[model samples]
Target: MFAFIISRLLQALPVMLTVALLSFAMFAYVGDPVAIMLGQDYTIAQRDQLVADLGLDQPFFVQFMKFVVNAAQGEFGLSYRLSRPVAQLIVERAPATLELALCAAILALAVGVPMGVYTGLYRNSWLSRFFLTFSLIGVSLPTFLIGILLILTFSVWLGWLPSFGRGDTVNIGGWSTGLLTWSGLKALILPSITLGLFQLTLIMRLVRAEMMEVLRTDYIKFARARGLTNRAVHFGHALKNTLVPVITITGLQLGAIIAFAIVTETVFQWPGMGLLFIQSVAVADIPVMSAYLLLIALMFVTINLIVDLLYYAVDPRLRIGRGKGAH
Candidate 1:
């Protein structure tokens, strides 16, 4: 397991470097960030001076090295637009995005696993038909469309929830267990549903297919024949084996959810890294944008590491497959 993890870490190093370098290059070349930041009135010399001050005049390698060294000291650089530390901006806003992503993930798991399990179990039954139709719509429809539809139905027409932001300013920092009560959960419903839609569909299908495949295996058949009840055959034996691949897919999906959170945060005006990232991009605030991307990359790396660690506990084959599975 240790060897496998070390290998995965080694593999990820180059990928992380490439993603960072490519993202930074795109930031540099896609637009005149200085011009975008400084606006039209700034003269050519002024822009040049600003570039030099920001080390834009330096070689690309030099700038990258500087960013790496400075970043090591916990300096993510200043946001040209916000005139604030990029790290601070992200830290301040991390909670909202984290809360939203977690809520969405929970909602997806709650709805998707059961939906898939029952659908696959029943096969051609009415419940199976219902899930099949629902999964099709959930999978086919884009996330933003789901968000809009929810807003129209629940907020606009039904007037059941507030359409924007986390909540009133009064509730911003206060933590009451009661907040998790009805009103708080209600506030979470729309955003959770909107963010969870695609994941739910994805998990439903994955779990269904996995469950069905597991049920057909010799062990499951034997379990059923050995006087094991249908419930035990399906839930215990089948679901256990299904978790291995499900773990891999679910972990990757979580990383994807973080990426997609940017979009959902934008659509709902949810206060999160996504909202901040969009604002930073629009202003060409390189530091904040870069930090946001970096943090996101770190999230993937960290989660993958955790997932890899989980393998040893789940199955010894994962630990034993060290070299034979090497790329």
Candidate 2:
């Protein structure tokens, strides 16, 4: 397991470097951060000094190497727009994005898995058909549209939930969280649902399909032939196997939730990293943009590594295969 982890980390190194290089290259020339930062009143000498201070006058590779080294130490310089350290801004906004993503992932798994199980087990049932139809809506609608519709229904029309913001939060050792407050929880509902809806449908459909496929396998027939109860054969045997693929999809979808929460965040005006990134883009905040890019890439790599590790836990066959190969 240690070797596997080390190997995965080694694999991730190049990917991270590639992402860092690409992000730096792309954002480096996007706009005149000097002009944006110094404003119209600055003299040419001041501009030159600013450019020198920012290392803009250096060779491209030199600047890129500096960026990589700085980034390694969790420094992305200063945000041109916000005039704050990019890392600090990310730290402040990260909790909101992570919290929102966590809630969305929970909603997707909690609701999707059961719905999928029921649909797979009772494929001909009216409830199963209804779930299928509902899933279609969840899958078909765009995230922003869903968020807006939800805001209209729940926030505007029903007046049950707040439309925007992270609501009230309590800072615990510099980690701000809304989970402790009633208003915070309420505020989370619509955005969480909107962000998770597509993932929920995707998970449900994947689970249902996997479940159905697993149920038809010869092992399932053998289990039934052994006079196992329907519940035992279905849940104990088939569901366990069904979850192998579900775990993989769920892991990837969780990463997707964080990466693609931009649309939902925009619609709901959630004060998460996605919203921050959007705000930064208007002025071409390179530090924030590059940092966001690197962070997202890191998250994806980490999630993929975790998912690979989980395969050994979920599917014993992987462990057995590894053991055999070792021997």
Candidate 3:
């Protein structure tokens, strides 16, 4: 397991390097940070000094190497727009995005898995049909549209939830969280649902399909032939096997939830990294943009590694195969 983890980390090194190169290269030429930072009143000498200070006058390779080294130490220089350290900004905003993503992921799994199981078990039931239709709607709608619709229905018409913001949060050791407050939890509902809806539907469909497929396998027939109860055969065997693929999808989708929260965050005005990225883009905030992309790539690589590790836990066959190979 240690060797596997080390190998995965080694594989991820190149991916991170590639992403860093692309992000740094792409953003390095997007706009003049000197102009944005210094404003129109600055003299040419001041501009020159600023450029020199920022290492912009250095060779491209020198600048990129500096960026890579600094990034490895969690430094992405100062934000041209905010005039703050990029890493500091990300740290302050990260909790909100991570909290939102966590809530959305939990909601997706909590709702989707059961709906999938029920629909798979009783395909022709009216409730199953309703779930299928609901999933179709969830899958069909765009994220921003869904967020807007949710805001309209829940926030505007119903007045049951807040439309925007992370709401009241408690800071614990510099980690701000909304989970402790009533208003915070209420604020999370609509946006979390909106962000998670598509993932929920996708997970439900994937689980249902996997469940159905697993139920039809010869092992399932053998289990049933042994006079096992329907619950035992279905839940104990089929559901367990069904979850192997579900775990992979769920892991990947968690990463996607964080990466693609931009639309939902924009629609609802959530004060997370996604909203920050969007704001940064309007002014070509290169450090923040590059940092965001690099962070997202790191998350994806980490999630993929986690998913691969989970296969050994969820599917004993993998462990058995590895054990055989070792012998």
Q: Which is better, 1 or 3, measured by lDDT?
A: 3
lDDT of 3 by residue, 1-327 (tens): 887799899999999999999998876777777787887798899999999998999999999899999999999989888989999999999999999999999999999999999999899999999999999999999998898888888889989999999889999999999999999999899999999999999999998999899888999999999999999998899999998789989999999999999998898889899999999999888999999999999999999999999899888878876666664
Worst 10-residue lDDT window for candidate 2 reads: 318-327
Clashes of each: 0, 0, 0
TM-scores for the candidates: 0.86, 0.95, 0.95
Model 3, runs deviating above 4 Å: 41-48, 324-327
Score each candidate by Cα lDDT: 0.80, 0.92, 0.92
TM-score of 2: 0.95
In what order do the candidates fall by TM-score, top score first?
2, 3, 1
Report the C-alpha lDDT of model 1 over 1-327, residue by residue, as the tens digit: 566678788988876777678667766787676776797797888988998888899998988777767765657877888888988888877777777778888888888998889887889999889888988998899888888888899999999986777763234553222135465566667888888888888899999999889888999889988999887888888887887777787888888887778778877888878899989889778878878777888789988888877766787676556647655
- In candidate 1, which residue ranges exceed 4 Å CA deviation? 30-53, 168-184, 322-327
What does the lDDT read for residue 126 in candidate 1? 90
Worst 10 residues of 3 by lDDT: 318-327
Off by over 4 Å in 2: 41-45, 324-327
Clashing pairs in 3: none
